[model samples]
Target: MSALYRQARPTTFDEMVGQEHVKEVLLSAIRTGRLAQAYLFSGPRGVGKTSSARLIAQAVNCTAQADKPCGVCAGCRLVREGNHPDVLEIDAASNNSVEDVRELRERILLAPLLGSRKVVILDEAHMMSKSAFNALLKTLEEPPEHVIFIFATTEPERMPPTILSRTQHFRFRRLSEGEIVQKLSRILQTMNREAEPAALQLVARMADGAMRDAESLLDRLLALEVPITLAQAEAALGLPPQEALWGLAEALEQGQIRQALADAQNLYAQGFAARTLAQGLLEAFRAGLYAKMGLGAGPRLESSEEKLVAAMTALDESLERLLKRSDALALELALLAAFQALHGSAASPQAAVPGKPSLPEFNPVRRQPPGAKHPLPEAPPQGTSTPTPTQGPGSRPQMAMDLTQAWRNVLGVLKINQRAFFREAAPHLEGQKLVLVFPEKASFHYQSALKNLEAIQTAVREVMGELEVSLVLQGEKKKVESRSATSLREGSRNGPTPLRGEASAPAAVAGLTSTGSVSASSPPEQSAQSAPPSSPIAEPRVAPLDEPPAIAAKTAESALSSPPLPGDEPPWPDDEIPEESTEAPSSRAQTLVDDPRFQKLLRTFGGRLRKLVQDTPKAPDAEGAAQGDEGSDE
Candidate 1:
């Protein structure tokens, strides 16, 4: 095995391929004779923190050493062999207690046995307990001239601030992909090995910025014969091919549960580890996002052109972002559950609950709810089971639907347009009309859907049963008038006021009235003459900014002769109810709601309407007045 391939560990600082900045500082200290009593080295794994510490020990104790370390020297050889008496390498992870640190402090009091400096290398120093750190604080503040402490940790944040402040800290950075690739190539060339650059690149990528990892991976590859290919790289790394990943995605897109499950099963059968699958899925989602995020036209998915590349790109981006936010274990569990639900056996009486996916307690993970129901095309009402998709790429699913189902389909298309309002107002549907009683009429009248009757009806009638929807605007007419209000009011089967107005709410140019009880029996022309042209105009008062805009008050002061009760429709005078008129009591009521004084009138007359007829008095003139009017309202 040695001859076949041995890890060519760094024998000197120069041989340490990456982390040039770290090597320069350490070497400068050795050359300048300005070494610190304690040092901290922090970086990702396989970046040579421990190896550098070893090299520093040999450099400091060298009887006959070169710029970094002379492997030929006895001290250097001993240090490399891990048996140097003067140097101690401790795993802080294992001996992280106060007692352990106390023992080391006692050892530190003694002089160097075999070498000039007695160096203690504490690996994973971040794991040291608080008391252990406190126990060494005094010694660290004023250590022996010959004693040196090197603390190495992957996570610096975990270290105590006091301990960190005492030591000289050096940060280690990961080797970039290109750097790793170059180093791997040089290593392979130095060994007189033959390997494809692409294969080497693959190994470097798998290393993910760790030079040590890349080197070890290269050694693993070199164990086999030379001339490595992409297939060999994939197989050795246990990563799936890109095609398999795309297949998984395609199955998910189509909602082909069975095929998707079978594919997942095949992956497990073919030694497709769950973590590996998770990584592959992540990559696919990332690629999808990249392709979809482009606003301009792009290449379509070659495998499934039914979706424009743009559409797939969008889905990919969303899925990629979602996947990245979670853990690998979580992702794997989701994949397995999806596979099991699609391919695993359906409910046998003895099986676990049907429809719901069960993740193993051993993996003990939460699975995301299965994706939204995909709308598959319905067959032509007969023996056919497969219905083709309505070909258009979308982030959502589509159904092969006919015109008959279009209405319901359209409403489904809308789904819950406004959940808050629908949740509050849906239950109000009664008979053929749906009423929304708002606190202020302005909001109801200004509602967009109500203004655009055609669009609202089209959106609603598609999903809901055939019905007429009335958006009865109550309270006051909105200050801002538009098509939305018009749509709602136009469809109103019964308005609390007339839809058409003789004039705008505040336009009082025409009507004039006497202060005395204006006769309900007076004609419009005679009423117009009662007040002169010089009569002061009543300007429409606007509601406060904080309050919802108020509706235009109805012109009830001049129009209402009969009094109104709370929630009651005021009766028109006997001769006033026009024969064959289209006005509804509700329409008339709408006009009343529009009037600013209408509410006040209702309160005043309510007691009279609710009272029983206690006494009957006959006035001779009342006989003619009460002759034919159906209304008895006073």
Candidate 2:
């Protein structure tokens, strides 16, 4: 019997799963006879680079009428058996040397022993030394008509530009978990192997979208005599099940601190690996979020993981938060930290999550008014704190004295509660109105900011007292070739905390670990104090950086619409995301979010982010008036 199982091996081009685009391009190239001298296949491991290379070798060597290997043909059979003279396979990893490449170059010059073309397939090509790549460049640069090279590597970035330039590069994408599950389930059905739904989904996820990974996992499932469920698989793989992770999150949310710690210890005691525990719980948190989104019968789930999956469907802002973190390393770290937190251990310096988490802070700030003139009076005299009913479109805003202070208050509230406006805030103060400026012309980027305008206005009114609040949003205008221009753009870090201001921000740059410093990289704060008295209808209300970002934005917006102060700094430039105050390179220090600044912003912004564009340009010289085409098409 063959060492490989029939179900585990992909038999045809059509049967091959995922990598659809890669397969399509190759098939077109082959059918059109547009094959090149060399090809480079690169992507993450388990993502089909090597498999695709082998398929290409077979496609070219096949002596049949179909686009697939005919199995019985001499070339096809030889290729399948790993003995095709024309289909030369090499492990470039161990054989990475100048001499090895030289020898291969000599072989490439010769004609095929059996098939019409000679295909030299090199796996892990990135492992080839620089000298080796240099040696092979000449031959690879100009190979004979009978020669073709298929190079595969998990890391394409490591490959030299000279070598890369000569090859037709095809990026093999990572397979999504859903696709992997479909492929795995199909393979099991064809093999007549029974699997619990939980078992199957677990296997697919474990594959991380690599077809080969799914195959290997399927093989393991079949190898077991008994039926597989999530529990059994978790035991076998030393990874926590979805329930374990969900339960941990629930525990954290319910304030069951001891329970969280106990569950974490139990997981480790149950033989789960640290890395696996960290990542698995993180993923389960995301999955449970999806489950929580829907109320009734949860979306179809693996019978075993159904309960776990149902908990994830949350159709709210939290879901938005989950969708936002697309980077691999960030996801990994988030999960890893959750594990550490569950373990009752202090967050590793490496984790960098500051001491003040978000959930607890959400409530206290929500209680404050949008535009209250006086301080939040903690216990305002019964109804006395009501906004002193304002007259419309008037320049005489009663709280004019507190405008800057009110803006500072509103900015802080907005930063924590709602981010949409906080995101593209180049707000200008126009009388009592707060006109928010957007970075782009599209409605999508401006959608959120537009939606909560009323809530924001109310928030502003609560803080600034009895003034008309008109939310004006100006998209990128085509004011071409202006004699000169002045503007303020906002910037933020990728972390949870939105920057507060110059006062709340960290040093310009600080080294990461031992490497080069991680700079704040945000647009510098503009000062409300600088706006001239000639500003529009009102007087200047407050100083800059003394208040939160929302308040700053309100004040800036008021100032802008109020009137140009000639050389004075504008009123409503969004403050940057707050930094964790640190003497060293740690993102773990207490952020301004833990300070009074954090509280004031949440109260001021009215608890809703009407708008936010993740990436926007920096207004570096807006204060300097040294404007060039900076951040656009955000």
Candidate 3:
């Protein structure tokens, strides 16, 4: 039995699948009797360029009364049988010597015996020697009236420009996956064999748009002589299961580095070609990307658009590094890198605040209010008692007026570098001195300020007009005992017991974790007398370092605090705002606010964006002024 492709070789223009554009032009030319003397067919191998060439030859010499290439006509049959005296098919790859062209030139003088016109088909014509092409150039440029030449090549660029300029070039394109599948279905029907639609689809993809190649593959499968299933197709083609590739893609998307690496190694062990596997992964990822963009349907993998883009990017990079040789380590490393690229975003330093992980753990750090100097207490220990201030007779009183306003002014005037040194100072007026109390945790910040004391004093004097400033680092060990006792009492009287290590310890004992300091030349006794008044606002309260049990575990439970799903109530019921507020505005709306293109538009016409009340109307005089401005610009 001959090969399947040989048996299926198209003899007529209508029998050729795909290349409709090429077929239409050739058929139209033949029907109009305006055929070009020389035709050039170029495209990827097995897309029917050569087959189409043969069909054209048959059509031009057909003896039928209707359409040119009636297969039953003697002229068509003679060409199909390769016994036509007037027509010649040359394999230019082997007969590319000058002697071959010289002989052909001598034979061209003879007239046709069986057909009205002579046709010569040169396959792989680009392989011909330069000398041979030169010899054929004159005959090709001005051939006899009865002669026609058809040159087909996979690489047209290799052909000489002088020769190319004389021929009518027709580009043949690869068939679409759908088109290939349809053709395969028809072929299977001819064989009296059954194939699942999925099996045929797989065969189409494996063909990679080469119609002849697809036929050759189907020929092998038909040899099995069994009802072909998708599994059988995969085995016959030596392709790894789609599930395995999808699983690898899932692992990469989920940031499962180890799993992705293992999958690569496993596929390599299963004997799949590295280049072929990489190519498959690339195609799958490309399809997923298209689906994510709403361009087309793809594999049903439930992943966000961000993840699909990331996976595609990873696969693209990995495919480039993929070597066709035995070592699979390069591909494995690429998989690891891809997973890291997707997963590393969560662990980025920018995602973290002082004492919290990134979302959906919205345990946002307690940010200070716009003008306040201290952080707010975090979920304050219930029922904690405040200590009373002690007054001293000898204590000199600073300006008795509120210092908060003055403190804020000083902070604004301070340079950015200097502000970092003093931002942690919790200040309050006491007698004649302004006491700046540093929490034990901020002892390092206090130390950092020692060198910049003069700068702080100058900034303060400028803002508050010569007030006495005293710096005090809260003593660590002594206060720990007192605060722990207060916390325990509060826990016993009310809410849940505070977790051990819930309170922050002094930096001195915590290994001096941070470096910031302050220095002031005031007697310790004066600082002692300058205790802050019993008010929560008297000092900035520091949040405890230890996290609650709910926060310690990394889980989606913490994300409940984030914006709820559609129709859900706001997670915090006590807050007056409704749980389900309107959805956040689209990104396009936000982008418009700062879009550079919008900036250009603003510059082109002098205009500023502003809000207008519904009830408000422009006054006649204001309208006149606006018109005048427009007139002036014109």
Per-residue alpha-carbon lDDT of candidate 3 for residues 375-466, written as tens digits (9 for 90 to 100): 77776544675532422322223222235556777888888988887889888665446678887888888888877888888887776665
**lDDT string, candidate 1, 1-634, tens digits:** 5421124557688778778988899899998888899999999997788888988998987878545677668898888778998899999999999999889988988999888889999999988888889999999999999999999999999999998899999999888888877777777777777777768877877888877777777767776785777667777777887677777765754557567566766776677655566557555644654566663222223333323333334434444544555443444455544444334454455453333222111111234434326554442454554444533344113221222233334444453753223222222344444344444534643375455556546555655546566554434435345655774553332212213443332222122212222224455455444422221222112222232111111213213334543465444446655355367865774675565554433333323312211111222443322321213333
Best by lDDT: 3
Model 2: lDDT of residue 172: 82
The sequence of per-residue lDDT tens digits that candidate 2 reaches over residues 1-634 is 5433333556457767787888888888888888888999998887767767777777788888545665567776678678888887899899999999888877877878777788888999989999998898888887788898999998899999998899999998888877887777776677676778777777776777677767776776667787777788877766777677767676644556668667767776666654455555546556544566653222233322332333333212223444555343433344334434333333356454443211100012335544455665553345454443353335334434344454556666565546545555554555444566666553554677667777677766665554555443353353432312322111121112233443332221111100121123433332222111221222212222323344334322332233222343322345755544555433333444456655444323311111111122233323311111122111
Per-model RMSD to reference = 18.8, 27.2, 31.2
Local distance difference test, each candidate = 0.60, 0.57, 0.67
- TM-score of every model? 0.46, 0.48, 0.53
Predictions ranked by TM-score, top down?
3, 2, 1
Clashes of each: 22, 69, 17
Better of 2 and 3 by lDDT: 3
Pick the winner on lDDT between candidates 1 and 2. Answer: 1
Model 1 residue runs over 4 Å out of place are: 1-6, 65-67, 246-269, 284-634
What is the Cα-based lDDT of residue 41 in candidate 1? Answer: 96
